[model samples]
Target: MGLNVPTVSTGKKYTIEDYLKLDDGQSYELIEGELILVPRPRTKHQKIANRFFANLDRFVLMNNLGEVNGDVDVYLEEEVVAPDVFFVAKERLTIVGEMNIQGAPDLVVEVLSPSTARYDRKKKSRLYFRNGVKEYWLADPDQQLVEVLVAGEKEWKWIGVFDREDILTSNLLPGLEINLGEIFR
Candidate 1:
């Protein structure tokens, strides 16, 4: 599907207020002031995203580390993005506002779909890195792997890539581990 430009405004940079004004029942992300429509995920995409969210949510809740949420709008700087899965550390829960997350999450996960993989990997990653997101996970259903990136001094740094048989670990969420096999199953 091609990118759908919002009909609400022409040649204007969209803010969170403008994004809120969009009453259309469509998913969108404001990237550098442009309202980019996001397509619905495919079945495989949904499955993978749900699996990841389940694992993370369970572990986070068990350890009392933070809150886990999926498919929620996160306000980042001047942009608004809905990460497939996101985690807010216990101390940063203040960013979790009633309407939407008021800041970047501690960790952001995006289950790659054909429609948004490039933006997820590049544009969104950079935005997350710039806005203080500590970790980023790219779960690719087609590749059956998850790539981990952590915030670095200048940009997002590649941490590791775990395949189906491997286990995933994170520095941000110290004791948590995820089995790639279970996630891809």
Candidate 2:
């Protein structure tokens, strides 16, 4: 019988140090050691992200609960992901580094565009879930809906898909709320 063994990775594997060496002019994520460049968001995409960020940031800051950030790097052992919006509780602020957060944020939000829909829903979800993100939001501008997911024992469990008429409530932020109608406007 042949010996059982694990195969070596032929693909290039870059670390956090390597990720830091990249030019700061562009946005990128390191997934499984490969650099994946993120497309620049369109006007509609930026509007959605900005609106949500404004509401969320104000609430979190006023409550002294945590800090809300936009397009910031959340670092993992072998990967670096820049969620469109992410919140880190005040107590967990130690993870915040000079260049990036050392670990996962409490919540990670990704506002999807046509070019990045599949990657955001699949790869990013898996990455955030595996890295101990407590909550994840996938905001779809095309569908005008937001899907909320909470981490579970095995995987992220979908809480619900909220429409423009529904008020979006975040589980991580307890009592924070946002009007989807205003956000989608």
Candidate 3:
């Protein structure tokens, strides 16, 4: 799942709309004027994403918190990031427009693929924080843990870590906890 860093030609300015129009046979993400094209992950990565989606969907539905699905592009004025599984509250569903989501979701979860791990942990985290995302979860399959991010006054802060055999709880969804062991399997 190793991916090369997306090369940004020097001295070229690109708008958010300019990135969406790129059809170079690769998936590109526009973040803070940088263009990153992350290559598709391995089969194992896809399996992990699908499994996470199943558990996430079950938890969200059981608690009636929100809805989650893959392949949903999220708009943040300067960029678009599509998580492995993205969830937005039913009440805030109106933010979705004809083109893309008007803003970030209440909960954004991304399964770590080796190719995207660096950006997922650093760059994307910052982008999500800047865009007013309420909660962000970074699930590391290799490490078998989930790092939970909650918005702070000026930035996003890591609130907790759910390791294997531990439970994850979110302030956004009271009394809803997910066991990490099940997800690791």
Candidate 4:
């Protein structure tokens, strides 16, 4: 799962239209203009993502708050990203464009894999914060932990890391609490 070679850069910048024109079968992300290949999720990563998605989906649906989606194209202007899971409140559905999300989502969840852990924590976190993502969650299956980050006016602020023993809760998604123990198990 480790990416022996770091990000494979194109050495050239690309536009959103150009990115869309590429083969959809391949997994990639447009980072600042560099087309970086995203590695396939490992079985453990997929399992964690699926479990978290199910929990978030159920909560959002029951409360009629918003919609929860997985691996969808999210357009952050020139940079297009596909977060592991994203949630947009019902009131902010306008950002959900026909092709892809035109703006940052209310909340984004990323299940870390060995290859993309650093990228997700560094590049993607900064991107999400700058683009107006209210909240971000980094789920680490190996550590069995979830790090919650809240967006501030200037930067992203760390809320806290919840381990398997703690019940994960989101300040943005009020009443949306998830048991970490279930996810790690």
Using TM-score as the measure, the top candidate is 4
Ranking by TM-score: 4, 1, 2, 3
* TM-score of every candidate: 0.93, 0.90, 0.87, 0.94
Provide the RMSD of all predictions against the true structure, rounded to 1 decimal: 2.4, 6.3, 2.7, 2.1
lDDT for each residue of candidate 1 in 65-152, tens digit (9 for 90 to 100)? 9899988889887898899999999999999988789999999999998768888888888899999999999999999989999999
lDDT for model 2 comes to: 0.86
lDDT value for candidate 1?
0.88
Per-model CA lDDT versus the true structure: 0.88, 0.86, 0.79, 0.88
Residue ranges of candidate 2 with Cα displaced over 4 Å: 1-11
Per-residue lDDT of candidate 4, residues 1-185 (tens digit): 44331554667788888898888687878877778788888899999999999999999999998889879889897998999988999999888876678889999999998778888998899899989999999999999999999998899899999999999888888898899999999
Q: Model 3, 42-89: lDDT tens per residue?
A: 776677778778877888898787777775678888787777787788
**Of the candidates numbered 1 and 4, which has the greater TM-score value?**
4
What's the lDDT for candidate 4? 0.88
Taking all chains together, the TM-score of candidate 4 against the true structure is 0.94
- Cα distance off (Å), candidate 3, residue 172: 1.1
lDDT by residue for model 2 (1-185), tens: 32121212447777778778988787778877767777788999999999989999999989999888978788887888888998999999999887778899999889998777777888778989998999999999989999999999999998999999999997788889999999998
Clashing pairs in 4: none
**Model 2 error, position 68 (Å):** 0.3
Count the clashes in each prediction.
Answer: 0, 0, 0, 0
